[model samples]
Target chain A: MSDVSSLEAEVAKLIVRTLTLKVDPAQIQPEEPLFGDGLGLDSIDALELSLAISQFYGHQIRSDDPDTVATFASLRSLCQSIEKHRTK
Target chain B: MTVGWLRQRERGSRIASRFMIWMALFVGRPATRALLYPICVYYLIFSKQACRAIRPYLIRALGGPISRRDLYRQYHCFASTLLDRVYLLAGQGNRFDIDIRGLDVLKDRVARGQGCILLGSHLGSFEIVRAIGLTQQDIEIKVLMYEQHTPMIRDLFRDLNPAVADAVIRTGSPNSMLRVKECLDRGGVVGILADRLLKQDQATACTFFGKLARFPAGTMWLASILKVPVILFFGLYRGGNRYEVHFELFAEEVTIDRRHRDREVQRWTQRYADRLEHHCRLAADNWFNFYDFWEEQR
Candidate 1:
């Protein structure tokens, strides 16, 4: 797997573990949507995931941020934003 | 359960709201409040939907069959609170005799410089709680409100007190929770009215007034995630400028175990419903959720 895909895999695991989703992290398609249709995650899940991301990566993902929607679009996009913004 | 309240049209026009506000401020509270009798009668005679919506809750909370007099009393109570908002928001809180109970519960949190959640319901005037802040100056209270439902009344009150509007963290916005977290981090108090269930909210069934009613779990979720103290507040209007504000410490920190998410949230939500029911019994007319609460959506 490429570096980007590896990072995506890592973030996908975080999402599953943080939310305690019954599905396996490996089952999450990298390009699939993280909310609504794909993962069936709602706003509360998004909030819990954001809190987890902030604690794990030392990055605060604010919903008010213009890129937040795009950043949370998919596992691949989430990883990209984390790469750009992660402090630690 | 269906969220019929969302589709329920906001009553009263801008002109009517403006007239009420003008009378409330200039005509004085006593004189303006007398007008509520006619207003209540008008709503009682015309607004069948509202009357229908509140009937079940009244019957349940009152613990018997209700009369037209009882319904009129409820309407008058609601109108009184609404008119009092004009005075409260305008910083004329001294006009009323407010009896505050369990203030030390809030003071403890404020003194510790730890932010806490004040979970209130539609039972009474939440504005009275903010009025406490007006006098004390120590406790900083911010309201987390769903602004979409009542734009006209909200705008009228917002105009009366822009500071109250400025302090509101509007829900449904992307960054709503983030702002709530930031406010709590600063040792500020955040108040939320948790009675009404929005369409997008995930609800947990709780026995309220001897029947299972669905309450939005969003507040509990936020509290658990934030790991903050949750305090229940009720500011009941006890007729003729007498308001009673009560505060009770609900939880030092709300925790939701991931393995038992639904169970834990349900337990907490039930606890809230129990407390809400207790307060509802205390002031049946103060209950303001004008919708078919127990009806499940198919």
Candidate 2:
């Protein structure tokens, strides 16, 4: 797998575990959404997932970030941003 | 999958509110309260959406079949609070006898200069809490509100009291969380209504009143992340100018272990739902969300 794909899978696992999402981590499509009308994750999940990401990678996901919409758009997009920003 | 209550257009007009405010100051409360009967009758007859929404709540709360009289009672109770809000915000709040239960919780938190979350619901007038804060100036309060959602009511209240309006932290702004954190850092109590789902993103399905319903998790998550105490508050309308404000210390601090964050959120959210249910049962007529609460598909 490409580095981006592996990153997406890693983040997908994080999302599933943090949110306790019903779907399997392997089943989360790389291009699938993580928010409204998509994976159906809510704001609580967003906060929880952000904390997990911060703990794992030392990168805090700022809710007030200007590009928050695109940052949380999909598994692939989120992982790309995470890869760019992750401190660890 | 119907339109949520928060999305519904406010039924009262600005002109009517202005007129009522003038009438409240001039005619006084007793005469003005008499006016509520006809107004409530009008809502009971005309506001189909509100009527339909309130029925299930009344049925569950009353523990039996509901009558037109019961519906009218709920409307009248709401109207009474609305009229009182005009007086409350107008700085004539001393006119009513408000019994505040569990005030020590607030006093202790503020005394320690520790910021906390005052989580309230739609059951009664949050204005009562503001009224309490107004009287006790030492306890600073800030409310998180969606200023644009209810323009008519928001504008009316703002016109009534500019000081209160200035204290509002408008939701959805990029710096919204920043403002909240700043206020908390200063040991100011930040108030948020956690019962209703304002948007699809803010909602989480939780069991309420023996059925699954969507409740907002923003307040709980924010409190947990900030490591602030969560205090459940209710300003229940007790009919005819009598309001009771109850404060229960919900959590000293919300601690979410990374391994169990989702479960922790659900647990906290359900605890709030449980408290809200208790208060709703205590003051059935005061439960005032005028749209189908259980409308969301779980």
Candidate 3:
């Protein structure tokens, strides 16, 4: 599997857990947009994601920046940002 | 309706009502989904007289057309919101999008360590702001809050998300004020939700929604005295978990002159108000003030 594909599998799990999404984890494509026309998450989910990232891996994900849309643009990209900011 | 009879009845009923509210919060049960309903039904069933007495106040405060069904729904929604808040508070997760803009503005002021005031409003699930200190912003936040009426719910909130919970400074207490001053003196930030009116001699008339409405002047007073840079923020909730946390420097800088103090605050407060309203209009449903808003105009 490509590095990006593997990254998305993990993020899909997070999406399932955090937002209570019902999709199969493997079905979440790496490049699929998480916010729009996809998993159907919103601002509260963003806050929950912020809390999740901060607590689990000690990384801070900010939603106020445009990067948020980009990072969360695809599961793979979000993982990359998480990998970059992972405190532990 | 003897005065003595009414007073005794009031005291007796308050004690009983408080007990049930406490039970719902602390002890979750099978009928938990009906928590708010049971209480409202209790009131309607037992306290028919009180329901009739307070119906007008409820209609006016809620700014809604009155019907028993609608009122019940409103009351029930309020209860559901309270319950959901409690449940979320119990389990705060990690991995959030705490996007920031103009953070440098807040950072520079906090760097001065003069204990800045982080004025916020209830446009978004600002409970999300608890993620601040735990994330990019290193400032310790002390929030001033009016304790929720129910003690059981209050305790639940106290444990929701420790990052934010630990930072809260309850309002109307000297400790809360001292903590604000202490954070300021240490060059930290104090978060205060200033949009809502106070229960007492606390608010001043300010223009909102194109008319005069009550708003607290405390943000101005705090800014003038502590006189730190007041940063205004609004986490405009667009939908789901999507929020735009727009930040601004309410004032580039402030002066300590007593003469210009009130107008200075009004000027800056107006700016903050303007920004807040702009975002609020962006997502009316997410604005989330189910209770009375613009009480004076309405």
Candidate 4:
């Protein structure tokens, strides 16, 4: 598989688990913003993502920060931020 | 319908609702909370049939194939939430003090010169929402409500909440649509519950609780038409004798792809559904839709 599809696959799994989304994981796009423009994730997902990431990867992300919004902007951004901070 | 049977059902259900409400309110406080506990146990649980009806949903959502004993414990939690909703709805409040997290989020939307559609669900008491929203905020909260049973019941609701009576805008009126549009044009807030299926064709079918259920597209359609922010608001009953109001700006999901309006509405509504499910997952019993939510879909 191409690099884009691999990144999307990783993002897809996290999206389904974090948001409890019902759609296909492979369907998630690489550059698509996860929140408003793409998957339409609401604030509840933001809270759940924060909790889920903290528990699984030991990365604590705050919701209020502007960077948090951009960081969680898409599959690529979220993965990069997680990779950078994740201790586990 | 037979007059006697209808009367019986109405009277019986309200009494049941009130009893649970009292239990939730009184059973929480130091002075009266303990006394109300046994009543909550007897009415909400020992009542048997009604309690059993709610079990499967709670079990499926909460315990998730847990052992028998743990399932029962989750039932108790659900029962407690129902009791609290009752309290919030039926109890007397001289001064309803509230703490709304992300209050500014909603306030910010309203502050903009465009009116908004406030989408909520059957999760908690919509009645308590008006009591808080109208009483706490200066913005006019025009709620879209289906008319209730007899004039007597209407009177009872009015007596319980005077502010809401003034604020409620009944659905199905030509005048109601005009008024809601006027509210939007003037930048007021129109509250509508998007969870119930108004009609079969009018709904957006989506997966809920691992099953496909229809959700009305009222929130998306209206917001898209008005080109205004559609926000999701939830009034959560927390551990204290107080509530934590959750105001989320979910307007980002409201899109303008006219070709796929139906699916776009469904997709956007799914986000609303997911957000709602998250809250319901947290406060399992605080909801009031006693009927089988997924029963009609099939």
Candidate 5:
């Protein structure tokens, strides 16, 4: 549980850093949406975020992959995906 | 920004398009081209919205008042390109004389095995490039476009060559960028039309033809993120089955600094608008975005 939370926190920081969002990583809710109305991240952000994830975790979050939508749903889901697929 | 083009309904019916294709293929190029005169006149008389939308552009490009003859020529130019799509897509490109300028630029990229972005506009026949690619088996062209917008024309052309259909990476899909990235990684050329902007797109106001008009910054962002070479392509149609396909190396690499992202995007888009303007002057009738392009004026 602690490991998962830490991974989530790490992903939150990554997102904030990659997007240069004004909000603090600690303030981001695990269950809050990362796109659309929630985090307000657009498609360009998604591309940039995917690149960052691939570089940092060594796993490409492909759009064709069925798990992509679920993976990008929120910080928790994204962390879970990283935990499952991260090669590094 | 007013997405007038998106709001404007697609003009022709599927049956009409299919019939036109059948006529084009059966009757052949020259005979079928004669039919465009009546069709062009029909549109010039009827398509009031298109006329109103294009007047400003024609005035800007021609540097004078828009006359009926000028409008007819514009309509005829567009209709000619549309009819030629049948020949171009059906593997009958030999019928037309294509004057390809800057083939060396594309050949050099292919030689390097470095995937690049071919940034094009709606100025002329984009399909003509695909026809050129058919001769060169080495060049793999994948187009990123909004396929949903023009389903009738898209489906008709797609059926002409299933292989070309397969090369399309439809925009607005979640995996569209992923597919583009994969294609680029494989040293494949991805063609993108950077002229028009969707409602949700991030746009930068650029000085186009001395007016501050918004152009989508997303393509530049994608190029920067993927770190690929961008080549500006304009396939201008010269009357009587001749096409001047020009390719200019726009940027070796597009880099956006995080601190000045907006300014950088505007700079790149302005450069693109400048190139597009230059080409527009070269072929005034070739300007195909038959919509109120300068939303600011509206």
Candidate 6:
């Protein structure tokens, strides 16, 4: 797998584990929406994922950040944002 | 993002809410209450979704088959409490017969300089709780809500009393939980609705009214982590300008060890579900969830 796909896979796995979604990591489409209609994730899941990503990637995910919504849009988007912002 | 029943997408017009507030101010309580009958009739005819939502709840609460009369009564009861909110929020709670039972539970906690969590549901008029906040000078009550879900209603509250609006802690804000923690640390009461799950909220499947349902575990999690008592508050509307606000202590502290966090979250969540079921059964008509609550949204 390419580096980008690998990152997406890792993030998808993290999301499934963190929110305890009743879906497989492979089912979470890289380009599909992570919230609302896509994965049906809510604000509570957003907060939980923010904490998980921050701890795993060593980067703060501020809910108030203007781009936070877009960053949480999909697995690929989240992976890219984390890569761009990760301190470790 | 897709909207769910609890999400703030299709809330009624802000203008209507504003109109009601002004009407209550001009016409007084009895006249404003007469308006609710027509409104209830309107919802009963047009809002099939709301009717569908209440059917199962009413049947379970009443412990018998529901009738058209029961359905209308449910809708009317909901409308009555909502109309009463205008008077309550306007600081005219003295006009109504509000009997607060077990307030000493809260008073004792606040006296000990220890903050507590006031967990409530969408069963009755939460504005009655706000009425309590108005009279109590010793304790500060901060309400935690998802403001974006009901902008028009929140605006109505803001228009009526900005101080109450300012005390609201919007749930999705970055510092929302931090603010709640701070309030609790200051021996201030923090009120939250423990019933509905927000979009993507982690919920534990539990039994409500003998059927499997999902209840949000966030309240239990917060109570456990904060090491504070959790109190259940229910303000039941007893038709014709009378309300009975009951405060029961659910837990002294919600203890969830890291090793068994998920298990503990589910257990305490069920406990809350139990208490909610008991109260909802006692006052069947007051429960007002306007959508299919048991559906698997996630």
Per-residue lDDT of model 6, residues B106-198, tens digit only: 878888888899999988877788666534665778888877767677777788888888778887643466567668878898999988877
- Return the interface RMSD of model 6: 4.3
| Per-candidate RMSD, Å | 2.4, 5.0, 22.4, 17.9, 2.1, 5.9
Q: What fraction of the correct interface contacts does each predicted structure contain?
A: 0.23, 0.03, 0.00, 0.00, 0.31, 0.03
lDDT of 3 by residue, B1-298 (tens): 1111122132124454445445545775335654566776664566554445435434543456567764554445444434444433544223334466676777666666556677788656555554445334566767777654334444545544555566666664322454566566676777778776645324556666565656666667556645567778766544322445666877655554545655665665676667766665554334434333554222
What's each prediction's TM-score? 0.92, 0.78, 0.52, 0.60, 0.95, 0.77
Give the Cα RMSD of candidate 5: 2.1
Clashing pairs in 1: none
Q: Which residue pairs come into collision in candidate 2?
A: none
Ranking by TM-score, best first?
5, 1, 2, 6, 4, 3
Candidate order, lDDT descending: 5, 1, 2, 6, 4, 3
Candidate 3 displacement at residue A12 in angstroms: 67
Predicted candidate 2 versus true structure: per-residue lDDT over A12-60, tens digit per residue: 8888877767888887777777776678765546656666888999887
Give the better candidate number (1 or 6) by TM-score: 1
Q: Write the per-residue lDDT of candidate 1 for residues B1-298, one digit (tens) a residue.
A: 3587876788888998899899989888878888898989999999998888888899898989999999999999999998888888898888889899998898877889889899999999998886775337556688988887888888898889898888888876445777788788889899999888888788888898888988898888889988989999999999988999999999999998867878889999999999999999899999888787886332
Q: For candidate 5, what is the DockQ-based docking class?
A: medium
Comparison by lDDT, 4 against 6, better one: 6
Which is the better candidate, 5 or 6, if ranked by DockQ? Answer: 5
Candidate 4 lDDT, B100-151, residue by residue in tens: 6776766766777557777777675454454455435567778876655445
lDDT of 2 by residue, B45-79 (tens): 99887898778888888999999999999999888
Give the worst 10-residue stretch by lDDT in candidate 1 chain A: A1-10
Binned by DockQ into CAPRI classes (incorrect, acceptable, medium, high), candidate 2 is: incorrect
Show what share of the native A-B interface contacts model 1 retains: 0.23
Query: Looking at model 4 chain B, which ten-residue stretch has the lowest summed lDDT?
Result: B1-10
- DockQ (0 to 1) for model 2: 0.11
Q: Tens digits of per-residue lDDT for model 5 on B133-170? A: 53466677899988787887778888998888988998
State each model's CA lDDT, in order.
Answer: 0.85, 0.80, 0.57, 0.61, 0.86, 0.79
What alpha-carbon RMSD in Å does predicted model 2 have with respect to the real structure? 5.0
Candidate 1, A1-88: lDDT as tens digits: 3344777778888998888888988888888888767888766677778888899998898755888878878888888889998998
TM-score of chain A, all candidates? 0.91, 0.88, 0.81, 0.82, 0.92, 0.90
- Please state how well chain A of candidate 2 matches the true chain A, as a TM-score: 0.88
